[model samples]
Target: MTYFRSMLPMTSEEMVFEAVRKCLDDAGLDAGDVDAVVCGSAPDAFDGYHHKGLVAVEPSGAFAKPFSRVFVGGGTGVGVTISGWWHIASGLFDKVLVVAWEKMSHPYPHAQPLFRSIFEPILEQPLGPNLIWIFALEMRRYMERHRLDKELIARVAVKNKANAMDHPYAQLGAKITVDDVLKSPVLVWPVHRLDISPTSDGAVALLFASEHEAKKITDTPVWVDGVGACLDSQYWTNRDLSYPYYVYLAAQQAYKMAGITNPLKEIDVFEPYDPFTYKELHHLDALLGKPGLAPQLLKEGQLERDGDHPTSPSGGLLGVGNPIAAAGLMKVAELYWQLSGRAGKRQVPNAYVGVAQAWGDLMQVGQVVVCRA
Candidate 1:
């Protein structure tokens, strides 16, 4: 995976090739060994090009191979890995290459403005609602519902950025305190500059192999125990912003497939998408099927790298950088590294089972993957 950064010198195709090449090398294989390829990118608007997926075909090493791309806004990252999982599961391919890349820096002025197009033209667009504004509303709802202090919520950024200190790919890793977060410039009410992840340019690639081929590749292959994805109503106004019901539904599906009856006890590590600070706690609750539990976990320091249930040990989008599709996949990559005992300094001890989730699309889409080693 390419390092998450505000800007990379390479083009989108080069980034794709670089990640795919590294993935192949790590697996002791070559592009010819991959029977199929699946690519994920958030939007053509971010790349400033049409058919962004097709443009990545050659660089993704999909020439004359079964190839396709998947997009679900920010969910595209983990969504692509799920797509690759099925390609091998369906008995169609033994080896599959999954590539997720985003170049949010290409959008003029800022990538945040590109989000305006995601809203409905007739109703939502008139109000000029972007992701931050909508998320600010969601954050306020969560805070008010649970009566959570802004300082308590700020700990998410503090913990994640500090955790990123050991991450080589992290973009915003720092040793920040909650006081530092509360003092940062406020972009929207309750949403400080430190609360949001920086827009970035990066790519992440993963190789999926069938049980038969996986044994040949590595003795410590991380298995995809289950995968789930769900999309709620497009009209974001109709849903309860205080909690994410969609994420719970998606997590239930994945846990059930993995025979996980008790997630809080069975899952050793978590990598929930954290484009915003509160989202880490929010999604953690959904993943655990216990609303209001995440904030408490944070307060208790159970979400830290050395805590009982380590979360976002890769720094997450908050500190590592938000490269859309790549950030989500990076979570899955973190799981693979952690479970395989290869996470280096950020490694979670005895991390046998891990869950990674990503949300997007009008704040209603949820994508989840469960991995075991």
Candidate 2:
């Protein structure tokens, strides 16, 4: 694994092209076989580029293909994935290439200011708030409401970074204990620097084929069982930050589509967004339909890679790295790998139904996809 910050002068164009090329090669297809391309990217502010879709063409090798872009902040990756599914599921194309990328390091000073800018200028911006403040507020809210101790939350940080130890592409795997996380400097009250994932420059791509084509391509194709995305009203003030209401709504839609009545029993694994330590628990509580469930699950070791309710077996954004849109795709890709039994060391036992999710945009949006193998 490499330091994410020390990487990526390669530009997203090259990243997109290479990732798509790898996807095609793995699928045993050529560029000519791709009927269309769907791209997902973060704000042009992160990569410092305008017209991201058009700019990505040359390197994406979609020159003569129908090229399109879907921008959904951090949810861009899975967002484009659902879009590509539409292309094929709509019977408009047999194969659609889905790609997502982010170069957060391109922003001067850091992506932190860019994250702050996501706040409404009139109401929130004038307060001179940094992103950590909101996270702290959310963390404090979740903690105060549940009387959750810091050590219990620190376990997520320890577990996820340990899980990343097995991911070949991971950036922040360590053997730290809960005490270590507790000892790390606090960036904000109840929000330690160790609790946060590093902003990175990365890209990921996948090929979505029509069911008919997928059947012919591989005997062990991972089926897209369901997908759901939702957004909440702006401002954390509008809703309770402890529970991700939008995340629950999106997961419910996905579970219904997948015919899952009991998520804990029906779903084999979880890959929720984890840009922060508390977020993993925050999103899971909503996803599980029980508030304060995540802390118990984490303490019971149910979230370990080989545990009963495995979560973030790919190290999640915290361990593997967070490149905005690319991070979401990584979660989706991790599901594919776990389902197909291609995940090397991080693979779970007899994994079948799993969910991948990403949450961002005013801290209100949630994107989810269910996969079965």
Candidate 3:
């Protein structure tokens, strides 16, 4: 038995408190019944407050209760949810509520400057590099190495935004075309404005409970069968720029835990992180354990929502706004909705198992989750 509920809040403190309140309300369980709480958010520089975990405690209602906070850049949101599952699965807790949020509206130098903290201070930062530079570089390498053109990448943007047309929470929904993306103003060499996820302010929360507790909560429960997360060495320069090794390791661990040997055939849908268009393809190759097939698949339109293995049915970061932590959890939330038959127009036909993944932090961190209906 599995049942989960989520909340999206308006403020950082309120994000935590409202998530707890919504979980309790949706499941008809009192706050006292919760046995543990897990929280996640991006760095303090982005939030303009240090030790944000401490500030989140009171709002999370974790006073004297088992609680923990995990951070791994954009992967932190999914990391927190996986942490909550561990507590319940390990028999340490009967119920766990996971909360994730990011408030970019708090006066700060547009996320680019704050993103510098993820780079090596003595080396990378001196070059005045930001997140977009890395993504643009990756995109260029991906294009050159694979002999793929920008039009294909632009098509990804078009498809994802078109899919987001129905997503209520999406901030960048538009009926765009490959030409539109190609013509969009370039921010970095090959990366254009349309290719990037917009900085957003949002929060997301999820409730997880043991088998016994889940049965009593809701009729439709989506099981959290597998969860995995991993980080590569922070030394980004040491690794190959084209492929993401962390995503491969994370997906492998999650697939093994879920008894999934062939992700392309076993999983019904995908929600790969797409802060940049190329990431979605990069993660797809990793998720399928076949780096050679990504370019072929993209050329054939296999990654589209109507394709054999539909990806980003919730519009992903490319379509939906990127609230950092919340953005990753939004993918998980999309899986929950789809598996429960709640996704109205965006629902995939006969979806059984769904996989959602998030990659971030100097391109060294990956978080993955597998859900079953």
Off by over 4 Å in 2: 1-6
TM-score against native, each model: 0.99, 0.97, 0.94
Against the true structure, candidate 1 has what lDDT? 0.93
| Per-residue lDDT over 156-188 for candidate 3, one digit per residue giving the tens place of the 0 to 100 score | 788888898888767778898888888889999
Report every candidate's CA lDDT. 0.93, 0.85, 0.81
Residue-pair clashes per candidate, as listed?
0, 0, 1
Please say which candidate is ahead in TM-score: 1 or 3: 1
lDDT-based ranking, best first?
A: 1, 2, 3
lDDT of residue 16 for candidate 3: 64
Best of the two (2, 3) by TM-score = 2
Minimal lDDT window, size 10, model 3? 1-10
Query: What is the overall TM-score of model 1 with all chains considered together?
Result: 0.99
Model 1 lDDT per residue over 173-268, tens place? 999999999999999998999999998999999999999999999999999999999988988889989889999999999999999999999999
Model 3, TM vs. native: 0.94
Give candidate 3's error at residue 291 in angstroms: 1.1
